[model samples]
Target: MKQNIYNFFLMKYSREKIALLISGKASFIALFSLIIIFSFLADKFFSLSNLTNILDLSAILLLTSTAMTFILMLGSIDLSVEGIAGLTGVVGALMVKNFSNSNDYGLLSIIICILLGAIFGLLNGIIFTKLKIPSFMTTLGLGAVASGVCILSTRGYPVIITDQTIRGLAHIKLLGGVIPLLFVIAITINLLIWFVSERTILGRHVIAIGGDEAIAKDLGIKINLVKIMVFAISGAIFGLAGMLLVAKLGAGDIRNPYGLLFDSIAAPLIGGIAITGGIGKIPHAAIGAITLTILRNGMVLLGINPYIQQSVVGTIIILTVAITIERKKIGVIK
Candidate 1:
């Protein structure tokens, strides 16, 4: 009877099922393990205040990393997030009731900021698809252009937001102050992405393209359209992240998104998303973002040198990609 039960269980969970389970659970396991370690190392780590702080910090990173997941799944990279985010933040702040501008567009400014992000993202897709430019170079050049625009708009000054409602968004709490509204927004966006990725035809096409672009094309998947849409969606998400940052800071500076690009890219990679593509889930990226936030928070609490913290993160990213990347798919290491 035991043997039969064991055989039945084996039949219920095939190799693919087991692999998927591992991939999905790995990030959570790592997160919990770190939590345990940090709890022991830092007395304040498990405190409610510190935990809330970690979640607060994780919000922006979580959003950006979620955006990056789509592009990364297609085996492409986006280097434009930081610049786009900074530009959007500046635009959002300037359009709203602000110190630098008389225009009080209020909610319209938020929509405009998101639209601007989408437009830039669309530009990325057009240039890459129509011009035959590689995503790496295309996004890099576009990011630079965005950065220049941001500087030109601000003229080396920060714009202080005067919209009380917008500024208050950063402070709203939920669930007895254990959760911030910003975190709620981030999670909601992630859930939307998850639904699209797991339920829609576009999601299937995306996965197909990532698995093998050549095969996807042969199978009649609209590669260019899908890629463009992915980029545009990513851009919109980054734009929202920028606005959130501005709301939190109550001001918009061109330097606001300084380290976002790295954090977004690193989070997914650390979460075991293969850089080679086609092998990750949205939840994994979230887990990775939370883990990174915890790591940074713990480091600060433990009095670790800031420089060393960066080095440690970089090393972990390298090791993660080395271990998780499917080298066979890449064909060559350049």
Candidate 2:
């Protein structure tokens, strides 16, 4: 026992291990730091109501950011997130008991919306791979297409949900209303995705491809399939988020999911996922989501200007990416 204890302490610590350890905790550190600063800056920051608000606000952002993390890990960006979310929210609204339609699909509506998101993602993957288009261009074009569809469907009007059961789902609370059911659902799903990313072949391939696509291709990795799966998975999560958004807002508008794209991307990046790709964890996205939520929530509590808040978030993104980026690996710029 004495020998074992000594050996454990004597174990050599490599620089790589140290670096990884620090990288993994960077987001947590940022989250804690924000909490501490906010607690001091805003009297209500640490209150139960405020904390609950932060968690509730984080639900959708958490789901979207976690999905975005995988896309970033694949060295790709999904500009279609906002458009897909808007479209899916509208679809979910229209399909459910809504003022715009008599259709009351209930849970089935959610499933179709999620599946629609997956189909869009699959299309994005196919176009990106088979058509040899850059992910940026393909996703951007698809996003615009989605937005157009959304506008056409809405015809410049909002769809108010009339389904009491569906709307009530968002308002359901646990622990005497201290915790929201929607946030719990988001956390559960995030855990599932984290497991997939850490323990599955697809997840491993995503990291490998992002790290070095040339080597991954040479080593028998199905690059296209992995990329497609990642995007599809993200799309499905985005769909779920859209449905929940509709439930919470009791209406669906093209602008319902406004700022989601920015929040999703910023959360992952702020959490230590490199924009350049191939180096981060799913949990980091969750942490980043909470951090961003708290930052915004605290700002509002402190009476900060809404416009300046946007600037702060933008600056944080730029700074975090600069700090965590794998600059040595990316030797050239276009």
Candidate 3:
């Protein structure tokens, strides 16, 4: 007994739980470690200019991942981010930059685009919960539908920016610094997500529903309403992402980084959101997003091929899930 007790504290697994909670998922520790390592291997990787550049790059993924964190927390997943964001971006760009040059409504256009995204969320929820269809297949099918809308809207053409007001967001500096307004918007959205996930009754319901539907129902929670609301929330955020993307890139290319849904999910999973649902926090995935953006951006500067980048991301995702997922929570892998 004495030997066993001593060995437990001396063992590597003892600090594992604490580390997992503090900074494990999304390899937060590894990100910092790499920051130090790369500061030496590569020039100016840690310089203020380069660091600001990394933050700017991370904002988009963080925005998407934060919304994704909500969906995953409910033990649900939305694979439709790419299509939704793409649609939102194209719509917003066209609304503000029509060839007639009469489409400018400024910030109101942002609000309308966001609401449109929420409509998609509502559609996903109603189709899944009301129709009694599984969300997995529902989102997959809707993704295709949304993608088709993108094709029809742009006809495969990218929307260019003539609106100086919208373009200013992408180029303007905060306090005369390199920190674009884009990162600020992304971070603000994430702060709101943290509030919703941590402070409200609906947030509690989301956690409960994800953890166990039967149990949540037994507790008299409005399981269906909560589930539906989350999908809408995810959609609304994606809508904001669309507007932001257009502002950031000054164009709405149908085939743009709109296909980043995989990385969005991968970020949350790596940050320790259980695939089974009801088991993770929004902030965790946000951190994971930054970590991933760091890794990818670093890889780019290091001249790594983009194809191999996906492979590396895939490996990290598998390993993160293997280490962090509570497999017993899931009854079957299928």
TM-score to native of every candidate shown:
0.93, 0.93, 0.90
| Candidate 2 lDDT, 173-290, residue by residue in tens | 8999999999999899889998998777787777677666776786677899999889899889888888889988998877888899899999988888878677788888888899
Per-residue alpha-carbon lDDT of candidate 1 for residues 1-334, written as tens digits (9 for 90 to 100): 5334333433443442454466567778778988999999999999999998999999999999998988888888889999999999999999888888698888777778888989999999889888999998999999899989989988968999999889988899899999999999998998899888877777776766766788678666799999999999999998898899999999888889999989999999888777767778777788899999999999999999999999999998998787666656766778
Give the local distance difference test score of model 2. Answer: 0.85
Q: What are the per-model numbers of colliding residue pairs?
A: 0, 0, 2
Residue 41 error for model 1, in Å? 0.8
TM-score of predicted structure 3: 0.90
- Give candidate 3 regions above 4 Å deviation: 1-26
TM-score-based ranking, best first?
1, 2, 3
Name the 10 consecutive residues with the lowest summed lDDT in model 3: 5-14
